[model samples]
Target: MEDENNLAVLICGAGAAGLTLAIDLARRGVPFRLIEKMDSPFPGSRGKGMQPRTQEVFEDLGIIDRVVAAGGTYPRMREYQSDGTHTEKDIAERDDPTPAEPYHIALMIPQFLTEELMRERLAELGHRVEFGYELVGFEQDEQSVTSRLIGPAGEEFVQSRYLIGADGGRSFVRGALGVNFPGKTLGVRAMVADAALTGLDREVWHQFNNGNMERMLSICPLAGTDLFQIQAVIPLEGEVDLSDEGIMGMIRERCARHDVKVQSVTWASAYSMNARLADRYRIGRVLLVGDAAHIHPPTGGQGLNTSVQDAYNLGWKLAAVLGGAPDHLLDSYESERRPVAEAMLGLAAGLLDAAKRGEMRRGRELRQLDIGYTESPLTLNRPGRWGPLLAGDRAPDAPLRGAAGSFRRLFDLFTGSHWTLVGFEAERNITSGRKGLHIHRVGPGCELQDMAGHFRNAYGLTPGEWVLVRPDGYVAAMVTPDETSILQMFFSEVGLTDADGLRH
Candidate 1:
């Protein structure tokens, strides 16, 4: 609630996407306010598994350790038959190397914990969510966007330079902008639950079919609380009461060795899955991110991850342009992220189809592909099919040593609100501090080093390799031994011009 004339990015919905967007912008020193229609938190665990890419995003947001500490590593993601037959080969290795701190396995954590951790980060940045303030409508000019907000007291109008509809699938903002979320809906509804159980079989995730019924089961180990989240999928079409007893019995019948008693239940719910994608994610001064932009079946557990990553892709550019970097800088938000969304939609459809056909092996393996931005203007010298030359989506999380402390990490330098010029084992120089770039020298003698961390080789550097990391944690530019496009592309493409355009 600052000056009405002074507006930044006004976001709708404070869920995973909305909050992550808020936190990213805040960390970028951008002013933004997030609003949610509901006044209270959604009870029960929502999204469960955290993808590898998402865990990397959390690391950039400085919350991965918290999430990892809260979420015990499953070490393996398995797909099994109802009769307990392993289908897909277990995936345990990180693929597609990136300079980004963690090119590791996907971490599974409760969506609630992810949301809470993001909110805590936002709090640390002095931005609080305006809960219950629903977005009724919004109108945008070239310079600013006016949003109508409704809450308990009544109606309030908010104005911002840009408006992001991070709201759920039924996005009012998308509708206001006349975007079409065209896709097919599943006739087969799935019942998902997060309940306590005394299980007969122990596995991280179990997926298979019993006769005509197909189901997916996941046992995510949550930290702090000895409680575990028992997620089971029940096919729709039958008159099944979604009560605690019914869910427990379904799980018992599915897993128990007969005559097994049901233990206490924690939470349960049922919902149908739909695969949909917005025709366009950007229009004028308004844009869509997260579920507002696209949605798909929860098979890969990618809904939250996709949206949060969308924000990560957007947050910095929007913050930069709004904070007076360049207006065209914001346009790249669409150019870079939209295609990624399309790819995700395509991948999700494939997974859903595999699940529908009981092709669990195909689904898991396809989902395991950590395909980064292979096709986008953001990637450097990227051949249409291969991927970005300097790891477009994946940033190198090299073992960086800093002067502060032994625990310092690579993202630590970029997380703050400035473009970082990191010259490994070399001195860095800025023309002047007023130019809005931060330079830090990282060397072996520096104190920061992972004691037990796994990213020793991926980002573990030796003597001399120069890289320029953007505030968003993507490699803005890099100069490796063999590859060399460090100076010109970065300075010319990503760096700002005096004319106020993102010089690509």
Candidate 2:
């Protein structure tokens, strides 16, 4: 039996990335303690855009409804011109939801609200974020990670099977681990603050730019709240004053809108452009994630989104390995996510450069819908596949009919923390025997009927073809019924025996 005091995983930092991983692990019944160096939850809207991919992740985590209810869409941009006239433009082209991609547009919610929803969901799963616990130091061996933590009470030593540094860019754990964060600073400094203001239309994102691009200021209303987030570029050698008066004065000077009063400032910080990636994500039993692993410009709103994706990708692998899956299964986290981060870093840096030159544009690339892991070692694909969807592609959503005329969706079936086996025309007797597996058959008079044939076309599946959807919603293996051994081989390679199943 495992000791209750010794957690399976100890997560540092209770931000979006840390909370997400905690929620996923809790749902899987994995023992973990999520800690934050701060005494209370962050109370600002630092990273406010939730991409389509992240919405799907939230759906699987069972917090989609709460997120939708709490967040709103990105508002139109109203640029304040030099002639005292405003020009309105859409932030991005709006795309309606389709059968394949249910969430076609991004959602805008304050980062604090997003974390609150996740924390609520985590509490429902019987876990709480331990506040005021700071990880001062740690040492890890082949078997476990012993962490030195300082808290309100005092310094205490704790042990865990694994340690993850989800702390922000100034990660003590990452620094202690000696991982090299290699990248250059773009030398652009900016000041951001969340404040309650007046004399601005809350329906649009108000932008004020000086002539010849000498200065720029944007006051974006935080969705579903009475506050606005102030963002503006400062001089490379400019002084930064993070006090409330300083923030208000800076806004007044930059926007030149004396009518727009900064009534109150809640949170303020100065940040410089630093596009960097840790040379390695993992060193022995300690791992780095979120800002600790990668940091880039927030131009494309990819920093938080990418960080959340990292947690989503790593959560299941951690659960699997703790449950007895092969140790190498954990290695795929770095192999798959590093490339995505690398791409995002370049994309964000380029977008930042473009914005500086007044050539910024929003497109499908920022949505992150097309990111995949087709090149990962765990992805099994056949040559000459007859479909656009492949082994490593994201499993799309489709409508389905359950028994007794019950209606459901493909994402509803993939909502839990378990590997799902979906068969088109295969026998259930062969696929349903596995423990902790949810098997669904899609055919006439079957457990699940493709109500509109969306699944068939979306997956490009023949009658006898089936696919293995990993717990994280990636296609692990796709094969015909005659090649069912491929599933067994893949599972065996990952050591997915009874020992590797979920604890509960």
Best by lDDT: 2
- lDDT by residue (53-96, candidate 1, tens digit) is 67766767788788888775543445555465665445344455
Candidate 2, residue 307: the lDDT equals: 94
Each prediction's Cα lDDT score?
Answer: 0.65, 0.86
What does candidate 2 score on TM?
0.96
Q: What value does the lDDT take at residue 486 in candidate 2?
A: 70
Each candidate: RMSD: 5.3, 2.3
How does model 1 fare in lDDT? 0.65
Pairs that collide in candidate 1 are 99-395, 99-396, 99-397, 100-395, 100-396, 100-397, 101-397, 398-459, 399-459, 493-504
In model 2, the worst 10-residue window by lDDT is 495-504
Per-residue lDDT of candidate 2, residues 235-319 (tens digit): 7886788676777787777767878887888988888888999999999999888999999887989999999999999998998
Q: Candidate 2 deviates by what RMSD?
A: 2.3
Local distance difference test, candidate 2? 0.86
Q: For candidate 2, give the lDDT of residue 167.
A: 98
